[model samples]
Target: MSSSTSSSEPTAAWARFLRLLLLFAAVPAAIAYAFIALVDPWGMLPLSLPLRRETVTTNQRFSYPMIAQDPRFDSVVVGTSTSRLLRPAQLDELFGARFANLSMNSGTAWEQAQLLALFTRRHPAPRVVMVGLDKEWCESGPLRRLTPRPFPEWMYGGNPWRGYGEILNPFAAEEAGKQALAMLRLARPRYGRDGYADFLPNDARYDAARAAQSLVPPPAAPAAADPAFEFPQHALLAERLAALPAVTRAVLFFVPYHVSLQPRPGTLDEQRMEACRAAITRIAKARPGTALADFMIPSPITREDTHYWDPQHYRIGIAERLARGLAAAAEGHPSAEGDYVLLVPPVGH
Candidate 1:
């Protein structure tokens, strides 16, 4: 009987230990879940916590879609950091339609494609779409994903259930807390209403030497029968744009990159860019009401370093000019010389 009692004593002790362990684990988890449910960062839960009117502070990959799908916006500007300076309000006024700038920093072509697809697939198709084409979209690797930091697919995907798990993440929780504080007026919004964030100072100075250094010719490559230009991703972009109905005006404009970003006038890189441009031109021709505004061509804006904050990014003023020029081109009006060439399809195509 004594031996049996001792054995049972150990069993009871183990049972108590298990209960304590479960409580310890369950309590914190319950608290965390409760917190996440309350926060509901990605709007996955039923709790509609008044998240601040976030513009720039939020991860654009996650936030842009939410705003784009709001149905209030009928026009959208999609591109990389080069396109972020564009104000949605400006586009709205220019085109006389509600607009949202869905550009992200280093936003990959695949990512942009996904966002565009998501936007167009909605019940009411978008009225206008402006794609800010750049090297990333024109270069190879259609299947290639975003690098350095992968785009969060769960947040962008149609499944709301998966988003609950996303908000439970530590990083997302931190963002939720920031949003909560901002909503409560404890913090300020990180960006303005139009999703324009000025990362560079307005008074940024240009150094001639620095610009010269950036212009150093790249090492020569072995001569080929034709310049090695691979742009399968651009084809995908064309396909998506073509899928849009004739009512939608799709504008594909090459960002006016600084001379440094562009290849030397007659080099192999120039050849590659030309090939990409030709391919895009073909796509534009195939689709009715689609226009290709070739700002990638030689231009005063592309030549002047003073007009740019960096070799790749132009100033906000340039963005304004580009916006005005695009608006003018869309209306069949003349714009500033040497800025862009507006290519429209032949009449009655």
Candidate 2:
């Protein structure tokens, strides 16, 4: 009896210790899970507790779907970081429609397609769908669907159940805490609700020396390309634009890159670029309520070093000018300021 008692006591003690260990582990895990579910850091959970949400993270691939699917916004601006500065409020006024800027930093063409898919899925007849074409659209190879930054494919638009597992992570828990702080007014929003953010490092002034440092000299002449060279990404773009309703005004503009980045005249680079532009122009012409603008040339905006924050990004004044140009381009009117040229004028022009 004594031997049995000793053995059984240890066994019971071991079981109790294991139970305590599990209890400690599960308690915190449960709390964290509840916190994430309630706060909905990504602002996607259907059961998310009532809270005023703002974009609290710079991971735009994850943060932008909120802007894409926002009910208040009936239109979306989809592109890479170059398009982020196109303020939604200005576009709203210019286009006479509610707008959301869903541009992502370093967003690949495929990623932009996914964003467009999400917006269109929610809004079948958006007033406008502005695609600020980037290099990815003209890139030669198969379109790279994503950038180096992590993109949550599940969060974009998919079976809702797929994301719960993905979002239940330590990173999401941390975001939840930050989101809670934002709700409490202790933290500030990183990007605006409509996904506008002046991400450039504010300068006291645009120093010519500083601008020159960021600008690279034009590239040396490149070897001739094979005649069969093609732009396959344009097809992807065509597919997306074709999905839009006829009533939806689709404005496709080559994002105005700095002159230094533009290809030299009549080189293989220009050959491929002009071909891509021609392809996009054809797609615009074939579709109603669609227009195309070419802003990739050596315009006053593109040639001025002071106008660009970098070869890929422009300052606020330039962004405004581009926005105005887009408004006119949508109506088949060429840029009055000569910042862009209309390739496919609007319908009825």
Q: Which stretches of candidate 1 lie over 4 Å from their true place?
A: 44-47, 50-58, 204-223, 333-336, 345-349
* Candidate 2 residue pairs that clash: none
Q: What is candidate 1's local distance difference test score? A: 0.72
Number of the top-ranking candidate, with TM-score as the measure: 2
Task: Score each candidate by Cα lDDT.
Answer: 0.72, 0.85
How accurate locally is residue 332 in candidate 2, as Cα lDDT from 0 to 100? 87
The TM-score of candidate 1 is: 0.89
lDDT of 2 by residue, 3-68 (tens): 999889999999999999999999999888988888988877778888688788779987887777
User: What global local distance difference test value does model 2 have?
Assistant: 0.85
Worst 10 residues of 2 by lDDT: 220-229
Residue pairs in steric clash, candidate 1? none
Tens-place lDDT per residue, model 1, 308-338, is 6666777778888999888876665544686
